[model samples]
Target: MALMITDECINCDVCEPECPNGAISQGDETYVIDPALCTECVGHYETSQCVEVCPVDCIVKDPSHDESEDDLRAKFERIAGN
Candidate 1:
């Protein structure tokens, strides 16, 4: 599943650069992750970098975009063009 940023986000900006997929962006109040671009770092890293860098632990999975690992890998490959 794709990850999302919760209201608990302090807008610390730490998680933005950590996201290898470039899915995280500045939202109205907090950083938000684009579900379409989010692959949980499956093809890039062992874990979600945004969640890993978020100090407040605000990054969580988006149940709405629930997808299997194969789907995530496809998304990653599509974004990476490989």
Candidate 2:
């Protein structure tokens, strides 16, 4: 599944740079994760960097964009131009 930054985000600015897929960005209020670009770091790291660095633990699996590990890997490959 993709990840999402909830309203609980503290805007600490830590998660943005940690996203390997460039999926996290500063939204109008809180940081937002683009489901289209999010791969949960499947092809990059063992864990989601943004989630690891998030201070508030606001990042969570996006139930609305639920995907399997294979799906995430494919998405990551696409993003990486593989």
- Strongest candidate by lDDT: 2
lDDT of candidates 1 onward, in order: 0.91, 0.92
Give the range where candidate 1 is weakest over 10 consecutive residues by summed lDDT: 46-55
Q: Tens-digit lDDT track for model 2 on 22-66?
A: 898899999999999999999889999998998788999999998
Best by TM-score: 2
Candidate 2 ranges with C-alpha deviation above 4 Å: none
Could you report the Cα RMSD, in angstroms, for every candidate shown? 0.7, 0.6
Model 1 residue 13 distance off true place after TM-score fit, in angstroms = 0.6
- TM-scores of the candidates are 0.96, 0.97
The superposed Cα distance between candidate 1 and the true structure at residue 64, in angstroms, equals 0.4
